[model samples]
Target: MDEELYLIKDAGVSPRQVRLARVIVGLLVLSAVIATPLATTPLLPIPGYMSAFGIAMIVVNIILASLLFAKGLIESKESSIRLGAAYFFVTVIFVPLIAAFPGGLMEAPIIGSNSSAVWLWCSWHTGFGLLIIRYATSSDDTAGTATSVRKSILATIAVVALLTLGATLGLPYLPEVFRNGRNFFDDSTILVPALVFGVNAIGLLCVMRMREEKPERLWVMVGMVAACIDVWLTLYGGARFSLGWYFAKITSLFTSLVVLISQLYGITRLYHGIAGANKILMTQANQDGLTALSNRRCFDQVLEIEWNRARRDKRSLALLMIDVDHFKKYNDCYGHLAGDDCLRQIAQQLLRVINRPGDVAARYGGEEFVVILPNTDAAGARLVAERLLLNLSAASIPHADNQPLGQVTLSIGVSATVPGPGASTSALALAADKALYEAKESGRNKVCTAPRELVTPAPPAFLMS
Candidate 1:
C-alpha cells in the first residue's frame, strides 16, 4: 500500500534526477563564466568558448526539462530550495559573463563564429521557461487543483510576454542607444533594461511574499512594469547604433525571463503548503482530543441535523447516555494517564458498535458518552443499552473491588421519542439525566428509563438520607 501510494502520488522523476538537475545548472553557470571573457574580448576570438558556452546552456535546458519531469517527486521544501538555489546561481552568473565579453572582441567574423553564444543564450532562457512550467504543473498537497492551475497559467503567460518583448525590441538597437549620444532612443536602451530589471525584481519579491501567504501586490505590479519595459527596450535597441546598446538589450531580456521563472516557482510552493495546513486543521476539528473519538461538537452538529430530518418525517429518535461506573475511583487508583487510555478504549468500542447510518456517538464529557440512534424506538434503545452494558462488563476493565463490582461497567440511561408538535430537546435531555441517576441508585451497572410523565410516590430512604 505504501509503495502504491508513492507511485500514485510520485512526480515523474527520481531523487537521482533532482541531483542531476542541480549539477547541470551549476555547471552551466561555471561554463558561462569561463567563456564570457573570450567571447567579449576584442583582442582574442576564441571560437571554442562560444561552443562551450552553448553546450553549458544546453545542459541547463536539459536540467530544467528534467526538473519539470520530476516535479511530483520533488515536492519537499528541501527539493524546492535546492532547485531554487541552482537557478539563482545560474541567473547571477549570467550578469558578469555577458557584460564582460560584450560582443566577442575579435574583428574577424566573430559574430558568425558565435553560434554557441546564441544557443547558450537560448538554452538559459528555455531552462527558465521549463522551471516556470514545472512549478506550475507540480502537484501540491495543499492547494486545490483549480487554484494551482490558475496561478501556474497566469505566471506562465506573464513570463512568455516578457521574453517575447525582450526578443523583439531590446536586442537590436542597444549599441546606438548607448553610443555616448544624447539621442532619446540611445538613452532608452540603457534605461530600459534597468527599468525592466527593477520591475521584475519587484515582481520576484511579490512572488516570494505570495508563496509565504502574505498580502502584497508590489511584486506583481513590478513584474507587469518590467514586462512593458522589456518590450520597449527590445524595440528601441533594434533601431539603435551602439554595440553596447545591443548587449544591454539581450541581457535585459535574459534577466526578465529568469525573474519570471523563479517567482512562479516560489508562488506554487506557497500555495501547496497552505493547502496542506487546511487539511490538517479540518481533521483535528472532527476528532476528540482526549479519546480520539468524535467530540461533543461533532456529535451535536450531527445529532441536531439528523434529529430535525427525523422529526420532519415523523421518525423515531433514540439516545443513550453511558456513564462509566466509579470512573472517579478508577482515575484515583490507576492515574490520569491510564484513565485516559481507558476512555479512549471505551470510545473506540462505541464507535465500532454504532456503525449504522443515523447512529451518532460522541464523548459527551469526561467519563460520559452519548449515542444517538435515529429511526429507533424505546425498545431498540433498550436493546442497544443492554448490548453496550454486556460488552463493557465482559471486557472486565479492572476495578479494585472484586466481589460485588467485579469489573468496570457502564450505567446506561436511555430515552427515545418521536418528535411531535410539542416535543422539546430540553425535556428529553432532562428525562435521560433522571434515568441515569436512577441507574446509579438501583445498582452501578444497569440500564434505567424515566417515565414519560411525573407520578406522585413515596420518597426513598436514600433520598431522606
Candidate 2:
C-alpha cells in the first residue's frame, strides 16, 4: 500500500482548536462593545498614521497572498488559489486607496476626488467578502492542476485591474460616499457600511457552514467575524477620526493577521513532520532487514569514506571477509528458516567480538558477512579474526551437517593496509575476497591471510578447528 503525505487541509480540527476560535471571536466582540460608546468621539487626526497603516496592510496582504498561492499549488486545491487571488486584489487596490486619502503619501490624491478613498475602501471590503464566499462554496471534488490554477490567478488579476480602473475613472459618476468631503455621517455614507456589513455577514455564514469538514475554515470564519464587527463599528462611529473608525481599521488588520498566523503554524507543523519522515527513511535505507546489520550498500559507502580517511591520516584500515562453512548442507538439513536463524546468531557473535566504534559489520550477501576495522594493523586484524572464531565456537549454534565438530563454523579472510595515495579502494576488498576463497579451498573451517604483495595481509595465523 502507498503511504499518504501530510497536508494541513487533511488535519482534523480538534475540540480545543474550535474552543480557541470561539474565545477569540468573543474577545473581538467584547472589544467592539467597549468602543461603542466612544464611536463618534473625535480623536487627533494624523494623516501619516493612515498612510503607514495602509502600507502595512498592503505588505501583510501581499505576504498572505503569496503564502496562500504556494499552499494552493502544493496541495492542488482551487479554493486556496481563489482565496489567494482575493488577497492579491486587495493588495493591488490598496495602492490607490491610500494615495487617495487626504495628505496621504503625496499631498494630492491619486484620483482627483474627495470621496475616492471612501469608495475604494468600500470596494476593497466588498470584493474581499465576495471572494471569501466564492472560496467557501468551491467544491473539493476536482483537484486543481498547475496550469489551471495559474490561469485562474491571471484572470482574477486582469478583472481586478479593470474594476480598479473603472472605479478610478468613473469616480465622478459614482454615488457620493461623503457629503461634507470629510465626514462619513451622511445618509449616502450609511449605505456604504450597510452594504459592506451585509456582504461580510454572508461571507461569515458561508465559512461557518464548512467549519466542520475543513478545520482551517475556523480561522477564516474568525477573520470574517472580525470584518463584520469592523463594518458595524464604521456605522456606529459615523465619522472619520472617531474612536469607532480607528477601532474598525484595527479590526480589519486583525482579520488578515489571524489568517496569516494560521498558515504559518500549519507550514511549520508540516516541515517538522517531513523532517522526521526523512530521518526514518535514511535509517531504513542503510540498515539490513533480517539481521539488523549495515547492508551492502551502506558498507560500500562507508568503505570508500574510511579508505579516503586512512590515506589522509596515514592510518591502517582492515577488511574481514567472512563466510559460513558448508552452509548449503546445513540449510538442506535444517530448512531455510533455521538457516536464517543461524545467520542471525552468527551476526550477533560477530558483533560481540568486534566491539569498536570505528568498526562496521555488514551482510555482504547470502551466507557472507563483512567487517571494516579502521586504524587497525595486520596483527590487530588477526587478533580480531581469532576472537570472532572463539566467540562462534563458544556460541556453538547447532548444525546437523557433514562436519567433524557437528556445529557451525566460519572461513574468514583478513587484510589490513595503510591506503597509498594512488591505491584503488577496491583493492582491499579484492585481496580479502581472494583470501576467503583460499581459506575455503584449504579447509571448511579456518582463517587465511592474503599475500602481502596484494595488500598488507593479516599475519599468518591459521586457526583450525
Candidate 3:
C-alpha cells in the first residue's frame, strides 16, 4: 500500500512545477526581508504610505490565490494546491485589517489598544495552521475517490466564518477567552501564540509524514515551523515594542511568501500540461494515421453536422462512395506494400477532386472511401465522381492483372439529397452503397448515380482501363 502511494506521488509531481516553485520561494524570502523593515517607518500611523507597500503585497497575493483556488476547484485540483490559496486568503483578509489598525504594524505599539486586534491576529495564524494540516493529510491528487477537495475547502471557509463571527460579535456572551483579549502589540497575549503554535506543530508533523515527498510540501513545512517559532518568540521574549516583535513580523511575512509563491508556480504548470493533453487527444480522435485524411470517426461527425445543416437550411448534400476496382486482386498480385502505395495514390486523387470548401473526403475502410459535399446537387455529384475517375486514370499506375489497358481505375457511386424531416439520411448512404454495388456488378470500372428515388444506370464515358 505504501509503495502504491509512493508511485502515485512520484507520477503526480511535476519537475517544471517544482523548479518554478523554487524560484518563487527565493523571491518570497526577499519580499519578507524587505516588507517587514518598511513596516517600522517613522511616518504617521495611518493606513497611508507606511502600509502602502504591505497593502500592495496583500492585494497581489489575493489575486494569485484566487487563480490557484479556481484552478484547483474546477479542474483536477490537489489538496496541497488549495493550501497555497488558503495562505493567500489569510494574508489578504486578516493581515491587512490587523496591520492597518493603530498600534499594529501601521502604528507604534499602543500598550492598550482595541482587544479585537488580538483575535484577528490569532485568526490569521490559526487559519494558516488548519489549512496546512488539511493539505498535508488530504488524499493525493491522482487518487480516485469519493473525496472532493473543493467541497472540503468550502466547508472550512464556512466554519471559519462562523467561528470568527462568534468570537467578534458574541464575545460578550462568552468568557475571558472570547471577550476583550489584549492585543499582541499591547499587553501581548501569550495564549494566542501558544495555541496557534500548537496548531502549526501538528501541521508540521502531517506535512513531514505525507506520502508525496514533493519539494513544495517541504517548503510548506518550513514555513509552518518558522511561524510557530515566530509566535513563541513574540509571546515569551519579553516586551511588546522590542526586537522580538520585529523578528516575529519578519518571520510571519516569510511564512506567507513561502507557501503562496510555490503554489502559484505549481498550479501554472498543471494548467498548461492539461491543455496540451487535451489538444493531443483531439488530434488523435479526428485524424487518420495511414493516408493523413479524416478517419471514420471524423467522417461520421462531419456527416451528421452537414446533415443537420442541410436539413435546416434546405441545402443539397452529396455523398460519393468510391472503391478501387479489383483492389483485392491487385493486392494478391503485388503484395500489401504495393497495395498501400496504391491506396495512398487513390486517396490523394480523391483529395484533389474534393478541393472545395465544406467538402469532406475520408477513408471509410480498406479500399473504400467516402466524400461529403454540402450545397451540391445530383448533377454536381456526378461531375465530382467523373473527375475522381479521370484523376485516377491520369495517375496511370500499373495493375497488370486488371482488365482492359491493365492500369489502375476507380468505381464511384454518387448520391445526392435535400435533407428534411422524415427523409432518412441513412437512406442516402444506403442508396450510394447500392449504387456502388451496381457499379461493381455492371462492370468493375464505371460511375453510377443514385438520386432521391431511383438508381440510375452507370454512364459509360471516360472509363480508363
- Each prediction's TM-score versus the true structure: 0.49, 0.90, 0.61
Q: What alpha-carbon RMSD in Å does predicted model 2 have with respect to the real structure?
A: 4.9
TM-score of 2: 0.90
TM-score of 3: 0.61
CA deviation > 4 Å runs, candidate 1: 1-265, 452-465
The candidate that wins on TM-score is 2
Quote the positional error of residue 10 for candidate 3 in Å.
8.9
lDDT of 1 at 164: 36
Residue-level lDDT tens digits of model 2 in 364-431:
99999999999997778878988999889888888878578889999999888898744666788998
Off by over 4 Å in 3: 1-215, 218-272, 286-289, 420-422, 455-465
Output the number of the lDDT-best candidate.
2
Candidate 3 backbone collisions, by pair: none
Model 3: how far is 17 from its true place, Å? 5.6
lDDT of each: 0.54, 0.82, 0.68
The RMSD (Cα, Å) of candidate 3 is: 9.1
Go through the candidates in order and give the C-alpha RMSD of each one to the true structure.
Answer: 15.8, 4.9, 9.1
Per-residue error at 294 for model 2, in Å? Answer: 1.2
Candidate 2 stretches with Cα past 4 Å from truth are: 1-10, 162-167, 179-181, 456-465
Candidate 3, run of 10 with poorest lDDT: 178-187
